[model samples]
Target: MTDPTARPADPIRPTDAEARTLARDLIAHARFAALAVLDPDSGAPMVTRIALVPGPDGVPLTLISTLSAHTSALAADPRCSLLIGEPGEKGDPLTHPRLTLQARAEPADKTALKAHYLSLYPKATLYYDFGDFGLYRFAPLAAHLNGGFGKAYRLTPADLAQ
Candidate 1:
């Protein structure tokens, strides 16, 4: 038998104005994101949920405890990915729009943004200043947007410019 490989039809559509808008909307409104990073010791993929908010300059930012596994992973390897979007309550979850961002996590100054960050997530004030916690900014390198079935587009950093 011939070698069989899975090659499904390319469902990704051309990047368009609507796709760009949807991607920006998703990125800007995301309150939380699924962060993916490589386990430093094991060299395996790991994912964890993180509270995300827009930084002073509108880049995706978050405060994370240095104790968390994901934080350690980021420290060892800044490469990471973020998935932003939540399925709607009334429809098939698979049909919901979502955006996956490939980014590099960089350390951000906590003191400069402490008050602004807390303004959006007052509850974080409890541990925001903990010595183990640090602020990180997700600098997007590229992104894939799934606007629903048959609605996919690959976007660039500019397309997601806030």
Candidate 2:
């Protein structure tokens, strides 16, 4: 027999229904997220805000400039992290759910991914002319979703894997 105090095993391996719900919330509620990449010089962490476009695969993609600090970092080290949460309001922001996705940034083939990103964020077309603007895909390796009040879940890429 199992101990009564022991928590039940997770039915989901990488992510559960709750985790998916949280992921959807993060994609819908947050428009911009801070992308953190490793700096080449000191190997430190560098962060920048980027316009996020969620893909059907549940990964977030963005267009970044080669000149941007975060993009520079990505060029040096493809490993990166993304933080998405409710912008601080008058009330306790902790009450809202937040998600942090650990990912790998890769230069994506500009065929389908570009069209998908642009379809999701038509407004970005205005800045498409920038030479530095290039298609980058952030493939999530893992994620931590916190739904406040000690409710949190961990998700892995396998969760969203097709």
Candidate 3:
């Protein structure tokens, strides 16, 4: 006999193409994201809000200050995650789609990235050359995309890149 209260397994939405596009769009259009890093001393997880822009490889690019706690943590441990997506005001928050990316943060050539970064954040031009600030790229290793109820996918770097 079947258990009446048991919920059926959520089916994967046949929107792989769409999901891939959405994932890339999320990174491209996002102005900010929640960056989670590991604290060097305590080894506890820490999260901070950060500006987001597209990098050379359709990944995330960010400018972080060396003096900040998150930057220091990244220097010690490059592993991090970024939560991208925003919930609509009308729907159940859980029903909204979001992408969680597991990545490694590495310093990029600032000079190469400066113009691109400036185009997105023009105001940053004033402090663009600040010595304490740096350009870092997020190299996605894996990703989990929740595209609403019954819509979920585990994506790899290639999936997102395409």
Candidate 4:
């Protein structure tokens, strides 16, 4: 048994380079993200699962249907956040690293991102050309990376760049 009275060890901060690499990996490998946007009507936070793809520059991008509330909310207000990284089957969920990226979402040029997006999500090809669906690219404004329990770091857009 461990000493109950002993204070837990302070978390060690990763170097800027390490943090940047981790952030890049998370964005690049993310199959999906939990996207949060402000509701246009109530001004309240709303979140939904969204499929993801990384831009050539390693920025996270997604396809959203114009019919969805989150898409409408994004159109009204571009500011949003994406929570990336999912825990594995075993071990404490809190011990898994995750990154919260605060960004501005804007309509992307379909011609520019289509191939890239489809390459990541081959299944999307069926509906990708549909009128209602459009690609949106996120420009990271700031980021908070929680590198497992007691490990965290604040990152700027520059840090996330490839």
Candidate 5:
């Protein structure tokens, strides 16, 4: 006889393997993420949905216009957080297996990185006509993934510091 009540090892604490899997999964499934930029004057969070592209290094890249409020916020303070996942139907959303990334945003240099970003999100090319469309790179400082049903993990840059 075995105890069915026994939990399964409390899931794995984010290993390098887990981190890579989570990052890749988010990249593949998510089309957009809510970018949270801090209001420089009030130091409060302001979130907006922005199309995102994954870079070779797994960092997120986005195209934003200088006219947008979020873009203005980013210009004032580059530190931000992004949230991506399916909204839960019940219970706490945070525990429902979502991905949140603490990141730093910077205007991407018009070089290989920017080119790669554009290639990944070709549809965004249409927005270039806006003139204010500029590439912003969101380099991950840390990440947390809660793959519902008790699968949760945390990752930091040091974990992927290759």
Candidate 6:
């Protein structure tokens, strides 16, 4: 018999084909995500909304400003997390599907990504070439997907590979 006070280590379900499909779809179509990083100075968690795009092989990419707090934090510590997917027009927001990805931020070559990024976000061209702006890639480490109420799965980086 188990101790009454004991709790499960993780309530997440084992990954399945359905879960994989949902996770891939979310990552593949995500245009923007909530970026979470540790504040370099205060060590507090900071989250900011950012526009991101999927690159070759579904890797997440973002053009960020060096002056931004999030960028500074990422420079100090590459580990970060991202939340993708949005709630539908109807129903409680909590009842919708969402994905949280764990990743490491790494600097990406601006020249290689500029043209493609511009094609997707034309207006960004105004600032894409700014001296302080740079491109970065989020290397997936792991991901947690909440498909809906009672639906949760833990995914390895390989599960997200395109």
Could you say which candidate leads in TM-score?
6
Clashes (backbone N, CA, C under 3 Å), per candidate, total 0, 0, 0, 0, 1, 0
Q: Against the hidden reference, what TM-scores do the models get? A: 0.91, 0.81, 0.89, 0.90, 0.75, 0.92
Mind giving the per-residue lDDT tens digits that candidate 1 earns over 11-103? Answer: 779898999999888877888999999999999999999999888676799899988999999999999999999999998998999999999
Residue pairs in clash, model 1:
none
Model 5, runs deviating above 4 Å: 1-16, 87-97, 110-115, 158-162
Predictions in order: lDDT: 0.91, 0.77, 0.89, 0.91, 0.74, 0.91
Q: Give per-residue CA lDDT, model 5, range 1-162, as digits (tens).
A: 989988767565645686667666775566688999988778888888898877666667777888888888888888999987766688876565577888899887545565676677778666744677777878778877767766767877654333
Candidate 6 lDDT tens digits, 35-106 = 999998999999999988887768789999999999999999999999999999999998888999999999
Better of 3 and 5 by TM-score: 3
Q: Model 4 over residues 1-162: C-alpha lDDT tens digits?
A: 999999976564754887788888999999899999999999999999999989888989898899999999998999999999999899999999899999999888887788888999998988999999988999999999988887798899999988
Write model 3 residue lDDT over 1-162, tens digit each, in one string.
999999987565554788898889888888789999999999999999998888767889999999999999999999999999888899798898889999999999999888889898777788879999999999999998898887888888988894
User: What TM value does model 6 have?
Assistant: 0.92
* Alpha-carbon shift of residue 97 in model 5 (angstroms): 4.1
What is the C-alpha local distance difference test score of candidate 3? 0.89
Arrange candidates by lDDT, highest first: which order? 6, 4, 1, 3, 2, 5
User: Model 3 segments beyond 4 Å from truth?
Assistant: 2-15
Q: Poorest 10 consecutive residues of model 5 by lDDT?
A: 109-118
Error of 2 at 45 (Å): 1.3
- CA shift at 147, candidate 4, in angstroms? 0.9
Tell me the alpha-carbon RMSD of every candidate. Answer: 3.1, 4.6, 2.6, 4.3, 5.9, 1.8
